[model samples]
Target: MDGQHYMERYIQEVVRRLPKGQRVEIALELQEMIQEMLSADGEEVTVESVLLKLGPPKELAKKYRDDRRYLVSPEYFDNYLWVLRIVLLCVGLSVIFSAVVNFFLDPKQAKEAAMELLYLPSGLLAAFGAVTLLFVILERLHVKFEPSQSSPWNPSQLPPLLQKKAVISRSDTVVGLVFIVLFCMLLTFAPQVFSLYLFSDSKELTMIPVFDMEHWNVILPLILASMMIGLVDEVVKLVTGRYCGAVLAVNAVTNLCQVMLSFVVLKMIPFWNPEFFSWLRKKCDIPDLLPYITEEAFSNLFLGLIVFGTALELGTTAYKSLRYGKN
Candidate 1:
């Protein structure tokens, strides 16, 4: 290519990689620099020769950005991976659940379920792209997320050191972690597992999922966040091997959030499938055995259980916090 044409290609490559705000100015600067280099060479110069002297367009773009071109810097790379893993795990679980439900919903559609599994790669790619984009934004914004940079620690807040026998059990932590992961997967993917089922003479099982899929977008995220918090709490407990004020505080906060989220979801969405109730009432031979199946009754019961669980957690956390405070 001619000198001007070659320079245009090289500048386009560099400018395209750069942020939009800096593209024009950097392109002009690069052009000027190339011109200076060519003039200083004191000989006929091709664009190829000039670009060759400048190195790869990618590296040249980095230079314009002062070498801040990493999609995720080393400092945030671990966090990026951590977030990516969580996102992928959630997505994978949801996909798996959907596949299983589809298969069970109609055995003849097993092929469709298999086909649905094919979407996993694209789903994962989309999730990865989103997470990487977020990390890239954070990196460009120079957002620091050091846990140690938080409020100063107080020694007085430490819990009483427990005896070796009384320390947190590694097995318990491992089991809890596994349960949390599985719970998140099931909740995200196969929530229908919690639904009521009725078998008919046709040998087909009619299933009614506990929560409406329509509310999934709102409910799942809150539940996932709560599960993540629980996962972190378990990790912390395992690492520390003892309950401390910090642990108690985190547990309490997680419990509180979960309770609030549960209330919000229960209030906003119908928990029991009305169709399931109607089917059961019609198909079942025993009328007196069946309890009332109104939406309000089921919702109130579910909400009560959630509130009770949250209260129990808060009570335990408070007790532990007080014990730690005494120490």
Candidate 2:
């Protein structure tokens, strides 16, 4: 049989066991190699001769089978993953609880006045989604190899456009670095305003605002905190992109520190405890609500929600990182 006929049979033999996308790509590449090797004017290239020249079809199939276009790790997470959920849940629950309590404590007159300018949870999701998209796009366009060490799964070299950008895009790089620094600054000091929007009241809208601050104090700061947390998440993505697997463990400790500190501040305040109630009551007129908040029932529910939430986020992030982390 001719080279064309040989290639057709060879591809048919090899494509069945592979994934559809993988099969198609291998078939197309193999067809091209065969055509390049034996043009129409060439001596007859039988299936046997072509097979001999190209090497065993099983070996060829094995090569392609071993390759990975995008890393596919099993959804495996250990202790580190659970800790993240703990932190996020704790912070979310505490903030939500604080907002609800502070709002209702105000008189009904102050309620309507502040309703127009409260924090909305939707704003937090939007900010997080937007920033995370930025990283997702960058990850897709990136080259996966250095000049000296490479694989077929990795591009042999960076594209001309990316090479040019690397050589001459100092300003863009500097600006990106600057923005990252600014985002971290926001995360560290005042994470509350990241989601604050001067949202105009609309006839079509019916959602109630959550915070009741005098100005944007409640709405703005809560937004900032959500955005800042999202920023830290993106930072984790960026750092982990270069080194997957064990490298991400750095986040575990940092997150634990922040979560532990927040838990202490929220839960261990002496004045909120009735055992120290007399000293606190005389000092600043310790409110009944503060003591109530420390009660076992309330604390357990809040802590449970926090732990559950943190678990969900950690599972999510771990799965996501495992899928997209390695370049």
- TM-score per candidate, in order? 0.54, 0.28
Q: Give the Å shift of residue 273 in candidate 2.
A: 17
What lDDT does the true structure give each of the candidates?
A: 0.66, 0.42
Candidate 2 lDDT (Cα, 0 to 1): 0.42
Kindly report which residue pairs in candidate 1 clash with one another.
Answer: none
Q: Residue by residue across 1-327, what tens digits does model 2's lDDT show?
A: 344545666675455334545677878888887776666537675445555666544446656654334332111111112323333343344445444444444445456434423433543444345444544443454322222333332111211111221222323323433454344333433333332233345623222222222333433444345444544543443332333333345345434544554354335532123333333335554466555543454445665676576567566545544554432
Clash count, predicted structure 1: 0
Compared with the true structure, model 1 gives a TM-score of: 0.54
Query: Which residue runs of candidate 1 sit more than 4 Å off their true CA positions?
Result: 1-101, 119-161, 280-292, 321-327
After superposition on all CA atoms, what RMSD does each candidate show versus the true structure?
Answer: 17.6, 16.0
